[model samples]
Target: MNAERFEALAEAFGGDVARWPADEREAAAVLMAARADWARSVLGLAGEVDTALYAYAPPQASVGLADRIAAAGPRPGRGRWMGFLWPAGLGAGLAAACAAGIFVGAHLSAAAVSAEPLEPVTMAVSDQDFDFDLDGEV
Candidate 1:
């Protein structure tokens, strides 16, 4: 009903009144009629801008250029996961190799430790003080 309410309705519906609901259509029509002066000013400004835009002509485009570009198709490349696959595979291989090395080292260490023999120590006395002298008259 008021200018502010009309402006809000206009902003929501834009210039197309057909998009508004049947119940609100009558109210919008009444508001539009009441705000004729404001509507005329806005329409005049839009018309001037439209005329200015129409005055400038775009440059002529080459024939068949758009078709040629469309026909060229997309560039050749890998997918998003393709870039990560190689690095992931490489990391897994390195981890497996490290695990195998650790296993082998542990086994070798265990074998070396088990194969070593422990030596036994003994205590004995030497008999070097007793000497026989039976070479006098024989």
Candidate 2:
């Protein structure tokens, strides 16, 4: 199809070529015809190509395979409780661990502080070598 005609068709059909405006029904019909012709040509070639592809046969199972599969019983699907149980249990465990850690830390700190003795505050000074010279020296 020519570029101008394709552009006109594109505009008439809005952005989606599959949809057409009622006002441009005639133009939409022409575009549809062109598209149908193109699709028919492409589909014919696709059918031939598909026919040329080689067919594949699945491998056959061993004689005892059916018996073994039947013996295994139905496949186990996921349990509903596990979905809620695991997360809830994990969260509870973590909260307990955090609380235990905080309690231990505070207890140890209190014990250490209480065990230590308070030191006495003292001041030392040397006596003056000379006697008091408190006489008035006018």
Candidate 3:
């Protein structure tokens, strides 16, 4: 690797060549051996950053936060077993329901087709069907 690429890798991998990607490690080692002084300077700067990162301590979570998270998690029972079969079982249930609905619909439609047709009735309206007074009296 060239000096620029070696420096980039050192920055990214935090000065530890062992932490670098396997394919890049051998090239980095060759470049480091060829340009020892410059490589050491780059590695030294990167190592300072790595040391600071390693020394960092993140703030602790509030008490019972873990317990609350655990409490909200899925409980052991029917749901756990059902989770394994969820996709397949749900698809099967929907298919069965559709099949049942189709069967019932077909049976009902056939019954309707075989049933007797209703006779038509006729009605006539004439003026004699109602009596009216012009004066607003019942």
Q: Pick the candidate with the highest lDDT.
A: 3
Better of 2 and 3 by lDDT: 3
Ranked by TM-score from best down, the candidates are 3, 1, 2
* Backbone clashes, candidate 1: 0
Q: After superposition, how far is residue 56 of candidate 1 from its true place, in Å?
A: 2.6
lDDT of 2 by residue, 43-136 (tens): 4454453445435555899999999999655435625654555557868866888999999999998987899865677555556444556694
- Per-residue CA lDDT of model 1 for 31-52, tens digit only, reads 6697778865644554565566
* lDDT, residue 124, candidate 3: 68
lDDT of 1 at 74: 48
Each candidate: what lDDT?
0.66, 0.59, 0.84
Which stretches in model 1 have alpha-carbon errors above 4 Å?
1-30, 74-138
lDDT of 1 at 129: 48
TM-score of every candidate relative to the true structure: 0.31, 0.25, 0.50
Candidate order (lDDT): 3, 1, 2
Clash numbers, per candidate: 0, 0, 0
lDDT of 2 at 110: 91
lDDT of 3 by residue, 88-134 (tens): 68788678889999999999888877897756876667555555689
